[model samples]
Structure formats: structure tokens, C-alpha cells
Target chain A: MWRGVTGTARMCCLESLTYSACTRTIWSWRSTIREFVTLNVGRFKMPAKEVSS
Target chain B: MNRKQTSISTCFSYERSLEDLFPLISSAGFTHVSLGAKEPHSSYLSVSRRGDLLQLLHDANLRMDSIHGIRLDLPGALSSLTATAEAAAFLDVPVIVVHASSFDFDPSEFDERLEVVLNTCEALAPVAEDTGVRFALENVLPGPATELVRSALERLPSEHFGFCYDSSHDQIGGPKPFTLLDVLGTRLLALHLSDRIRDHVDHVVPGEGFIDWEKLCEEIRHSAYAGPVSLEVLMNFSGFKDQVEFLRQACRQAERLYPLVFGENAAGL
Candidate 1:
């Protein structure tokens, strides 16, 4: 019974760590995507550069 | 052509696969041409940067009447104006026509937008002055009145900057063409001539439309305008034979009507 409790606790801890890492990775990816979209939006709104042919 | 011919500025509509429009104008007694290049489509072959247009004008014994209708909103807009002006200057066209603002904004917002446009024009004035090219600001439907046009004129008084009086825009605003002409007469440098039904935005050929052509000719003669009277026509009208013949007749009518309305000595007057 003690082994079962300890194993269950260990498994929960591993699952929590895995879930936390995934959340962190997802959060970073979301931020990175946000930054990219923001930069592009800013570029498009600004006046285009002059190109002389 | 028995009579001396005036220049016909081609609108972007002429590129409707009717490639012979220019040649038709040349054959139909036009002595000069003004080519319009809309923004975003400036690189489009019809209005592209190639000097082929200028070359065509040269070969046809026609002088250029400046590149007409370049908006100030596009990327490199000022530079495009500058480049077109440089080309026009080289070709000795002397004037470039552009709208003060495209699309109508609210009257409440006009003052703010006018300030922006005026300030920008102030900045561009030096470039135009330096380059020896006149920048003509035309009136739009919701555009400034003769008063605003004059105020802008007073603020930025450069020889290379002036007003282009477009009859249709003024008529669209419900002003009598003669009164509008009289109001803008002093500052007017170029004329965009077309007949339109008052309160209707259609470009009916001169004399066919309800425009008082008699009064228009009278005003031009009275003002002693030596500049070209550019016929503003819809580009993709059907019946080439009809369009060509109508334009030629309009030219004749304008010539005949000019002397009679303004007096025979008006040309020299």
C-alpha cells in the first residue's frame, strides 16, 4: 500500500513537470509568434522604401 | 489637320486593349499628350516607367502635357512625382497634375487633412521649386474650394507650383463652371476639360454633355489660357469610329466656338 501511494505520487509529479514544460514551451512559442506578427504589421503600415529603377 | 491641334491627355482607361488610342489621337489632330498613372498600378505597362510613351509622343510630333493623375498616397509617391517631373521637365512639359487628396473624407475632418496636405506640399514645394517642375493640385468632390486652393497658393508660392482647374470636380460640387473658373482663374495653370451632367458623374463628350461649353470657351479665352485643354474621356467606350469622330468634332467645335464666343482677336487678345 505504501509503495502504491509513493508510485502514484511519483507519477503525478512527473505528469505535472511534463505538463508545466509543455505550457512553458507553448507560452514561449505564442510570444514568439506574437512578436513576428507585430513586426510584420508594423512594417506594412509604415511607408514603403523607395526603389529607383 | 488644317487647324493647329491641342494636346489630349490620355486617362488610364485608354489601355483597354485598344492599343491604337494614341495613334488615333495623333491621327485625329492631337498635338500633345498627357498620360495618367494611377498608384499601385504605376508599374502597369499602360502607365509604366518606360519612356516609350514619351518616344511615342515625340515620334508622333506631339509634345507631352505632363503625366496626369499621380496620387500622393502610393509608396515612393513623392519620388515618383519627382521622377515623373524630371522626365516631364526633360520633355519640357513643365507641369505635373495630381489630386490634393483621393477619396472623400468628412467635412469635419477636412481642416485636419488639409493641414497635413498643406504641410506635405510645403515640404515638397522646395523639391518642385528646385527641380523646376510645377506641381498642380486639383480639386476633388470633397476637395477644397477656390478659397482653400488660393490659400494654399498664398502659403506656398512657387513658380513650380500651381492649381489645375478640373471642371468636372467643381461641377460635381454643384458650382457653375464659369464661376468656378473665375474663382480659380488667377491660379489656374492647366485645364482638364470634359463635359459632365451636373450632379451626374458621367464623362459625356464635349457638346454632347450638358456643360455650357460656350461659357467654358469664353472663360479660357478671357483668361488668356495658352495651355492645352485636355479632353477627359472615358477609356473603354464602345465604337472606336464614334469616339474618334466625336473627339475630332469636339476639337473643331471648340476651335470654332472659341473665336466666336471670345471674339476673333481673342487668340491674340
Candidate 2:
């Protein structure tokens, strides 16, 4: 019974770790996209859109 | 061919400031631009003062070829065109391309809108004469709108009134009973050159659509228009994401079209 309990605790810890890793990945992706736009489009100070044209 | 024969519209860069747009146009090898798409140019209009826009164009080494005017059938069109003429005269731009208000092309409605169109021409005549900025009524739609435009141009005085052919707009409705170039050829002053992808999705780059540039050049050769091959393209259907790249491509395409437009005999406008 104690082994079963330990296993459940381990699973929960693994799931928490996965969730944290996903959050970090998402943040990294957001920053990468922001940087890309700044370096390319924003470099020329362009609109990057038709913007109702 | 003269480099002055090549011009691009400011409509492609409406999102950018007027100051930013001129340099981009210059960098793209265009010596002239059609003042189009109201925004950044309207900002210049709001100021009662003049010479600022002229100075901006001078700095960029560009000239204003034409300005697109508001729909003449709309309310306050006279004042709007007057303001445009005032601006054009101040900037030394010679032509203003005016649109017919309605897109509905049913022939039955021609009678109804006929008076409105003629009145617009009459109203604008004084402004054109005074400002010395010619008004070129552009063909919006084929059926009733074309009739109205034809009637106005026929009945009006040609000294200040003329025709601005928009190839994209004419490409719609398949073919009209009388060709625009056939009927309005003699009075052509300015041109808004672009290709149509579909019915209403227009202003794509030339040679990227179904328009036969070769045949068009033949027809335009007979017309009275002797100005630049001013393009009114937008990046909307061009599949170009970068403004500078789009401008360069447009300039290249316009150059390709120059031989087609000017022919082997005289060179470009």
C-alpha cells in the first residue's frame, strides 16, 4: 500500500513538471515571435499589414 | 523611355506616414506618384498651409502625377474636390481621378443617376478651370455607371474635363457594348493601371492576372493619354509581405510594361 501511495506521488510530481515545462516553452515561443517581428518588419518601421488599405 | 513615364500610387503605403512613403517610392525607382488612398495625404490636406507637401516631394525627388478624388455623386463632393484641387495645384499635380459613386451597373438606373453625374461635372468645371488641375472621371463600373460617365464627358467641356481609365474596373462585367478605350479614348489623360484577379478583388500587380498587356498597349496607343504608366497596385493580392520588396517588384513590372505601353517607335511617355 505504501508503494502504491509513493507511485501516485511520483506521477503527480511528473505531471507538475510537464505543466511547468509547457509554460516555459510557450513563453519562449512568444518571445521568439516578438523578436522576429522586431528584427524584420519593425526594422523598417513598417505596418506589416494592409490595415484597411 | 523617359524615367518620368514611371509612377506608382501612394495607396500601397497608406499605413506609412507621408514622410516615410515618399522615400520608399523614391528608393523603388519611381520618380512620380499618384496621391491615392486618403489617409496620409488627408493629414496633409487638413493643414491649411501649403508648400510642406511640395517640399517633401522635392526632398524625395518625386513629383505628384495625379490625386484620386472622392466619389462625385456623394454629398459634399464639390468641397472635397475643391480641397483636392487646391492641394493639387499647390503641389503642381495636374490631374485628379474622380470615381462615380455607385457600383450598381444596371442600365435601368442610368436615367436616375444621369443627372447626378452631369451635375458633378458641371460643379467641378469651375474648380478645374480655376485650379488648372484637370479632372479625369474614372470608370467605376460598366453598365449604368459607364453610361453616366459617358454622358457627362460627352456633354461637358473638354478643356477642364477628361477621362482616367482604370483597367481593373473596366475588366469587370466581361465586356461592355462600347469599349471604354473606343468611346473615351480621345479624352484620356491619366491611367490607373493594374490587373484584376476576380470580379471585385483588384489592384493586383500587372502580369500576375488575366489582363492581356499586349492588347491593352495596342488600345492605349490610340488614346490621348501621353503620361506615365502610373500603377495603382496594392499588396493585398500580390502575395508580397515586405513593402520594399513589393515596391521593387511593382517597379520592375511597370518597366516591363513600358515597352508594351509606349511601343517600339516612340519609347515611354
Model 1 TM-score (2 dp): 0.69
Root-mean-square deviation (CA) per prediction? 11.9, 9.0
Q: Give me the runs in candidate 2 sitting further than 4 Å from their true place.
A: A1-53, B1-4, B47-49, B173-178, B265-269
Report the alpha-carbon TM-score of model 2 versus the true structure: 0.78
For all candidates, state DockQ relative to the true structure. 0.01, 0.05
Question: Distance from true position, residue B190, model 1, in Å?
Answer: 0.8
| Tens digits of per-residue lDDT for model 2, B152-198 | 88888888989988888788745333378888999998888887766
TM-score, one value per model: 0.69, 0.78
Reference contacts recovered by each candidate, as fractions?
0.00, 0.08
